[model samples]
Target: MTELPDTRLFDTVLVANRGEIACRVIRTLRARGIRSVAVYSEADAGARHVREADQALCIGPAAAAESYLNIAAVIGAARASDAQAVHPGYGFLSENLEFAKALEAAGITFIGPNIEALNVMGDKIRSKNHVAAAGVPVVPGISEPGLTDADLIAAAADIGYPLLIKPSAGGGGKGMHSVFAAEELPATLATARRVAAASFGDDTLFLERLVANPRHIEVQILGDTFGNVIHLGERECSLQRRHQKVIEEAPSPLLSGLDDGGAVRARIGAAACAAAASVNYTGAGTVEFLVSDDTPDEFFFMEMNTRLQVEHPVTEMVARVRGKSLDLVEWQLRIAAGEKIDFTQQDVTLEGHAVEARVYAESPAEGFLPATGTVVVLEESVAQRPGVRVDSSLARRLKITANYDPMLAKVIAWGTDRREALDRLDAALADYVVLGVPTNVEYLRLLVADPDVQAGRLDTNMIERKLPDMAFRTVDAGDYAAAALAARKVDVARPNAPGEAPAASSWGRLDGWRLGDPAPWRSAWAAPGRTGVVTVSGPQADSGTEGPGVVHVNGIGGDQESRTALDLNGTTGGELLWDGQERGYRVGMLGETVFLGSGGWSVALERLDREAATARMLAGLEREDAAADPQLRSPMPGTVTVVNAKTGDRVAAGDVLLAVEAMKMEHQITATMAGTVHIGVAVGALVKADQVVATVEPDEDNSTTIPEGE
Candidate 1:
C-alpha cells in the first residue's frame, strides 16, 4: 500500500452518480460525519440519491451525456457546493482519467485512483504491457498497434484457431468478438471496430488467446501511498451475457476447486496480487483473470478495471467477515491525500461466501430488450433473513427509462458457505416482484437452480449454453397463479358493488326483497394478450337487501341465471368461479354502465333502443381502436429522435416506428404493421400522443393511402 501525508481529509465530498451507488456512498460519508453532496439531472430530481444527500445540485438535463458525463458541469457543481472532494460513484466518470485531472486542476480532490494509474489502466494495451513487464502471466496475444488483416490472421493462427478480438479501449463486452474459425475474422473485426467506436470512442483492438470453458475470476486490490498493497481475495463473475456479467459471487466456488481445498486457488490469488504491485497501482482497482477449469495452470490476464466494480458489495461482504470495514471511496480519498496503508497483506481475512445477482429492467423473452416504464409495484421479502442483503434504489411508482443502463438493482446474499448463500439468493429472487415493466428476474431464478451453476462449473458462456430456453421463459407458473389469486381477491372485496357480499356477515338485511337497490360491479379480466371489462348490477330493493346480480355485456343483459349470483346478504360472496377458484367482485357505475371489481370488468345496461345501442357500441369501438394504435403521437410535447422507417419501407408487425426524445430519454414508437409505410414523421420534429407519426398501407389491394404529411 502507498503511504499518504498525515492530514485530515475534506469535510464535504460530492457524489456525481445516481441510483444505489450514490445512496450507498452517502450513507458511508454520513456515518463518518463527512457531509455528502449530490448532483442530479432533470429526470432524477426526485430520485433516492437526491433525497438522501446532505445537499444536492441540479447539474443539467437528464441525458447522461448532458449531465452525469458532463465533466464541466460536474466540476462546476463541486466548486459551487464548496466540496473539497468529488466521488464518481462506480460509473459515469469514475474511471475517466481526464475527469480526475480536471478535478485536480480545479483543486478538488478526486476520490478514486490517481490520474497516472487511471491513464495506464484505462488503456488496455498499456496496462497489459505494464503487467507483463512486471513478470505477471499475461494472456498470449498480440497488443501491438496497427495490424493489417493478414497480420491479424497470422496472429490468430499463431494463438490457435479460437481467439478473442477485443477492442483495446472496450469494457462491458461491447466491441468484443470471439472467433473459433479463420473464415469469420473479417466480419467479426468489422463489427468489433464499429462497436468499439460507438462505445469507447476508439477502434483500436487486440487479439487474445481464448481459454475454453474458463471461469471469470477477479481479485480486489487496495493500495495506499505508503507502498502497501493487499489482495482481498477473489470474486467469481462467470455468469455473463454478451460479455456483460449478470451475477457475481465472492470466495469463488471454482477457486475452492469444488470445496476440496485446492493448491490452484492460493497460486491464483498470489498471481493477482503480483499483477497489482507490478503497475505500482494505488487506490481501489481489480485485477481480472481467466481461469481454465480443465487445466489449473492455464490462467491468464483478462483485463484490469481501474475503479470500484459494480459488484463491489461482495468484496465488502468478505471484508466484513474479516471484522474490518473497507471503504473503497475512503481508501481512494485517504491515499490521494497522502495516507499509507495501515495494515499488511497477512492481516486481511476472508469470511463467509456472498453472491450477487444484477436485477435489470430488460425483457429476457425479447432478446433482453431494455424496457422502460413506471414501476407500479416493487416488492421484496419483508424479512431480512440471516445472510441476506439487498442493494437497490427502486421504489414503487418509479419510472425506468432507456437513457441509461437497464440495471434496476443488485441483490446479494451472504452465508457461512456457498450453498447457504446460493439458497438465500434463490429465495430473495423468488420473493421479488417488479410490475409495470419487463424484467429478467424469472430467468435469473432458473439460472441459479441449474445443475452446472449449483455445482460451480461456471464460465462466461454459462448462460448462453446451459439456459438456451431462458429467453422464452417469461413467468413461473406458480407465481402467475399466486398473482392471479391475489388479483381475484382484490376484485371481490371492492365496496362499490351493491349486490357484492361483505367479507363479514355481521351486517344483516333490514327488509325482504321488493327489489334490492341497484348497484354496479366493475371487474377486470386479463389473459396472455387480451384484457376486457365486465359489469353487473343488482335490482333496486326497499328492504335494503341486494339480490343476485345480473350480468350485462355492453349494456345488454345476459340471458343466463342472472350471469352469476352474489351472496350480498351473507358473509363472503358466493364462489364466483372464472377459470378456477371462488373470487369476489365489487361493482360501480361508469356513466350509465356498471363496473365489476375483483375482475376490473365493466358492463352497461341496454336501456336505449336496439338501433341506439348498436350505434353507441360502434362509437366505443372506434375510440378503443384509436387508443390501441401504436402509430399515434406522444401524449406530451417531445422531439422525434429516432426514425426507424421511411416511405415505401416494408415493416413487420411490432417493429419500432420511431422514437420520441422527451425529458432527455428516448421513447420508441413502434409500428403495428403487416404492410408498407406510406407516411411518417421526420426526425427532430415535435409530436403529441394522437398525432400520427406514420401511416401503414396494408398489402391487401383494398388498402387506402393516407396523406403524405399530417
Candidate 2:
C-alpha cells in the first residue's frame, strides 16, 4: 500500500455526491484516518454511501436540481457537518466553476483543480481553443461563443459534411450529436441545443469535423500546488454505445502493441502534461484525445475532464509510483491539503494490465432501456476473488430509480498480461448477480468475448455496428427447470393443502409420491411472449438430496419438448447438470416470479396456475384478433419532457408523439400506425414504466407518414 502523505490532511471532508463514487471516496478517507461526511437526496436515504460514511445527512429532495446539484444545499451540509473540505465526486458539481467559487467563499477547500483550470478546461469549446494555443494538436472545428442554430448551419458548408456538434458545457457524452448530411444538421442541432440547455444550463454549441474510426484515449494527470505535474499512462475507451463508454482499460492496446519501444506513449503523455501545465492545473484530471485507428501515431486533443473520471480505477490498478500502487483520490486530497510531489514523472510506471466494465441498470433486450427495481438479491462475492475488485453502490432492498444515471457499479480486474486481465474480468462479470433489476452484465460478457474485441480492433462505433449481430442468451430448459425446482421447493416446505391432512401426518407431504411410478409434479412458468410447463418426477425435492431427478419441459417459445435426468441442488444456489456440464446457478423468488442467474445472465419466470395460464392465452388471442393497441406506453419510468402532438391531432405512422427522459436518455414514443392521437400525459409529468402516455384512434384517412421533426 502507498503510504499517506506526511503533511496534515483535512480533519473532516464532505462528499458532495452519491452512489458508487461517493462510497469510493469515503473508502480512501477512512484509509487515511480522516472523517468522511456523505450527503444524499431524500430518495437515497438508505443508500450504500449514506451507510458507509462516518456522518451522513439529507441534502434535499430526490430531484438533482434541488439536491445534489444545488450548490447552496451542498455547502450548507458541509458547514453543518464541520467539513473543512468537499469532494465533488465527478458529475454533479465536480467541475462547476460556480461551485468551486462558492466553496472558496464558504472557507471550504474544493478537492479538485484550481479555479483557472476549471474555467479553462470545464467548457469544451474553450478548452479546445486553449489547448490548441498551448501547442497541442486539436480537431479542426468552428468554436465561438453564443453561436445560434443558423450560424452553425451556415458554417457546416465550410466544415464540410459529416460533422460533430458538441455542447460547450458538460461531458460524459451528453449533448453531443453527429450530423452526416446538410439536411440532418438543423434537427440534430436543435436536439443538441435542447439537451445542452437542460443538462448543463448552457445552450452554446460548436461543431467539429467528424473523425472516422476514432479511438478514444485519455491520460490521467496529477498536479500539485507547487507547479509539479505528472501523467499516469493512458486508457482505451473505444467500446461505447450512444457516445457513452462501456468498457475501459489502461495502457491502451494501440500504444502497447506498437513495436517502437514506447515512443508513441511518451508523446501522448507529454501532450497530456502540457495541457495540464497550461493552466497551472492542480489535483487529478484527465485529458482525452481522439486517435485515428488507421493512423495510430497521430492524435488530436478532444476535451479535458476537470474532475476524477469514472474509469479512474483502471489507471489506479495498473499505475505505480515508486514501485507502489497509486491512489488518485488520496493524491487529490493531499494536494488540496498543500502537499508537494514526492515522486517525479519518471517514478510512474505502468505494470501489468487492468480492465474495467461498467455495470448498468438496463435491459439490453429492450433496446438497452434504463430499468428500475428494488435490489432483492445482490451477489458481490466475486470482489473477494483474486485479481478482482468491484466498486458498487448496490445494497439489498435498495431501490434503483431512473432519476439519475444508470451506472450502478464498476467491476475491474488486473493480471500479468492483457489477455489474462481480460479473462479475469470476464470471469468476474460472469460471477456477478443482481436479482429484481435488469442489467447489462450479460451484454458486457458477450462484448468481452467478441472476436474483434479480443483482437483489440476497437472503435467508438463498434458496439453500434456489432449489436445487431450479437447473439444474446435467452431463457432455456435449464433456466425453466431451475425455476420449477425452486417453486416446488417452496411448495413442499409449506404447510398442508386445503384437502390434505395436517403437517404431523406423513400423508400430508406433497412430494410427488405414489404407489408405483411417482405422480409427476408440474408447475407453469410464464415470461413475456412465452409460457412453459415443467414437470418433475422420481424424486422428493424436500429430501435434501443432491441427485437425479427426471424433468420434462414443454411449450416455451414453441411446442418444444425436452426430457433429462438432472442433478440439481440447493435453495439459493446450486450446481446443475445441464447440456453435459454441471454449472453453478443462483435462484431467487420474489412474489410469484422466480429469478435464475448464471454466467452474468438472469431471467425472471412468473409462476402461473392453470386458470391464469388459460386466461392469459385467451387474452393474447383476443389481442391478436383486434387491431394493434393504439395506446403508447412509456418503455421506462421517467419524467415526460416533450409532448410533440397535442390531443386530437392527426398523426401518421412514425410520427413522434411524445418523449420520456430517464437516466440521461430520451426515448421518443412514436405512433406505430397512422391515427388521430390523444395525448394522455403533459410535459413534466412523472410516468411509470409501461404506463400509457398517449392513445391513438386508428384513422384510415391518415395513412401518410409524417416527416421527422414535423
Candidate 3:
C-alpha cells in the first residue's frame, strides 16, 4: 500500500473533460468551496462546462487525441491555472495510469485510485486473477495473457461451446465477442483480436463461460486511506445495445431474490465489500458481477471499475435518502489529499430505486452508429413529482461530435418505490425532446414499456431479443408533426430588419357581402401524422387592415340563421379565431407574395415566378432521379475496401468497383454501365452513399456492340 499524504491539500482543481461529466464535477467542487477550473477543446469552447466553471481555458483542437487526451496540454493547463489537482471525468484519461503518474510527478493531486491500483485493474486478465486469489468467484475462464488458435479451441472446450472471447485489457464492451458454437470460434476470435489490437493495443485474449441471459449487477464500493470500505448496494445494468449500457437502475430486483428478510442480499453485498477489500481499493470504485437468475444462489465477478461510474447518479440518489450527500468528486479530491473515511460501513444504506437512461446522439436503426451535428432543438420537462431528478449537458444549439462517446445526456428519475420511479422515467422520456441528429428516445420508450423490463426480468440481451423492430422504426410521425409545427410557428413571427415587408392581415376577405350572409372567422388545424393547415372564409368587409381581412371558415356555407354572434372583422389585429378557439398565426407579405403559415408547411399566395420555380422543380427532379439510380454509384457510405478496375481496363456491367462497410456490415459496389473503366475513387478512400466510385466511358464507333438487353 502507498503512503497517504496530509489532509487539507489542493486549493483549486482543473477538470480535464467536456460535457455533463465536467459540469457534474464542477457542481460538487463549488459545494465544497473549492476553486474549480475547466478546460475545453476547440469544439467545446462554448460548452456548458466552460460557462459553469469559475475559470475556463482552451486546451487544443476538437479531436480528443490533441485536446482531452493530451497529457502534456492538460498538465500545462493545470500549471497555468495554478491548479493543485486534476480530475479526469470518466472517459479520455480517467483510467490512464500514465496520466495519474504524470500528475504525481508534477506534484499535483490525481483525484482517483493511485497509479498502482490503475495499473493492476487496467489489465482485465491480471485483475481477474488478483480478485480470484482474493476469494471472489470469477467466471470460469483461462487467465493466460496470449492465446494461439489451438489454445483458443482448447480453452473453448473447457469453458464449453458458448464462450465469450474478450480482450484481456478492454472495457465498455469493445474488443469482445460471444461465440455460440464451435464452428464460429475461429472467425469470432479473429474479429475480437483485431478490435482488441485497434482499441487497446493489446491483442491478448481470454475465454470465459458465457452466462446466458445474465443480469449485469455492479456494486458501488468506496474505500479510504484508513482501510475502511463499504458497498452502496447494487445497480442493474441489463438494458444495453452494442454492449453499451442504455438504462441503469439501482437496488436491483434480483437482489431482493424470491425470499424475503434480505438474507441473500446481505450475502451478495458482503461478497462485494470483500472484493473491494481484497484490492485494498481506495476512493470511489465499482465491482461488477454477472448474476444468473436461473441460479439465484450464485453470482460471479465480472470486473472492477476503478473510478466513478457513468451511472453514478443512482448511487447518489441512494445516498441522499440516508441524509448524506455521496459527493464522489469531493471525496476523491479529499482522498487524494489523504482524508480517511470517518463513517463506518453501517452508515451507508440502500434506499429508494433510481433509474437512469443515457441519451445518445446516434441512429439506433443503423447499429447505433455515432452521429454528429448541431442540436437544432432540445427540451426536457421539469420534474413536478417528488423524488425525481434529471441530469443533462445539452442545450438547443449544442453540437455532438464523433471524437468521443455518442452519449449526449443522462436522464435520471427517482421515487420511493420501483413502480413510481419507472412511471416518472416513462413520463420524462415522453417529454424529452431532441431534434436534428437522430436519437434513441423512441427506442427507450419501447424498453420502458416492455413487460419484461417492467417486471424487472431484464438481461444483457433484453433489447436484442425484445425490440428487433426498434432497429428499423426511424421515423416517428408524431415527433415529426411536433417538430414541424414548432418550426413553422418560429418562422412566421420572426422579425424583419429595415426595408423588410410588414406583417399581413390575419384573415382573408370574401367577395360576397349581404345582410343575410354569415360572418368570417379563422380556424386552427392540427393533424398528428400530417401537416397542419389553416382555412379562412367569410363575407367581405372592407376595413383597412395592415394586410388581409378575416374570413370565417365556419360560415363558408351560407346558413339562413346567424349562430353564436359570428361576425367578420377585416381590421382585427392580434391572432385569428378558428370557431372561437384562438390559433396563433402570423401572416406576412413581401412584394406581391403573401405568406401563410400552416404549422411547419407554408403557402405563398402570389403569382409564382415561372422561371425560378421551374428551375427549382427541375433541380429537385434531377436530384431524385440521381438518388433512385443505383447502377452507377456507391452502395453505402464507408471507406473503399478494394479497387478492382483501372482507368483503361475493359469491364463488364456486373464488375465490382469496390466494397464498403458501414457499422461493421459489408456492401459491394458494382459496375452498371458497361464500357471502358475509369476508376475515380481508390482503395482506402472514404466515400458517401450514391457517390461516384468509378465511371465507365461508353465505347463509340461500334467498338463495343450493344447487348440484347441494351
- Which candidate comes out best when scored by lDDT? 2
Q: What is the C-alpha lDDT of each candidate?
A: 0.68, 0.87, 0.67
Candidate 3: global Cα-lDDT? 0.67
Q: Each candidate's TM vs. the true structure?
A: 0.75, 0.94, 0.76
**Overall local distance difference test of candidate 2:** 0.87
Q: What lDDT tens digits, residue by residue, belong to model 2 across residues 1-710?
A: 47885656999999999999999999999989899999999999999999999999998999999999999999999999999999999999999999999999999999999999999998888899998999999988899898989999999999997899999988878889888999999999888888888888899999999998999999999999999989999999999898899999998998888887299999999999999999999999999999999888989999999999999999999999888998899999989999887999899899999999999999897789899987877999899988899999999888999989999999999999999999999999998999888899999999999999998899999999999988888887777877887777766677775887876665776675546766777788887567788877656333324456666778765544333333344457776665566767787778888877888888889999899988877877876765556778898999998889999898878888889999988899898778889899999999998898898888765455443212
Give the Å error, residue 534, model 3.
11
Per-residue error at 202 for model 1, in Å? 1.1
Task: Using lDDT, rank the candidates from best to worst.
Answer: 2, 1, 3
lDDT of 1 by residue, 114-136 (tens): 67778877888888888888777
| Candidate RMSDs in order | 8.4, 2.9, 8.7
Tens-place lDDT per residue, model 3, 1-710, is 12224544578999988888998999878877789999999988878889899999998997677999899999999999999988888878988988999999999888888676798788888888888887888899887776786798877887796888888875889867888999999888877786677567789988999897788888887788788887777888988866789999988877764575267666777788887787677888888889887876678988888888999998888664245657667677777778877666677777788999888766555455445555654556544556666666777667666556667788888888888888888888766666545577766767887888889888898788876654333222222222222222333335555565454422322322335534332223222111222222232222212233333221113221111111212211124333445443323333333333322222223322446445545654765554122235654456665677788898765666666544333355665545777778786687775577776665453243322112
lDDT of 3 at 214: 85
Candidate 1 minimal-lDDT segment of 10 residues? 597-606
Q: lDDT score of model 1?
A: 0.68
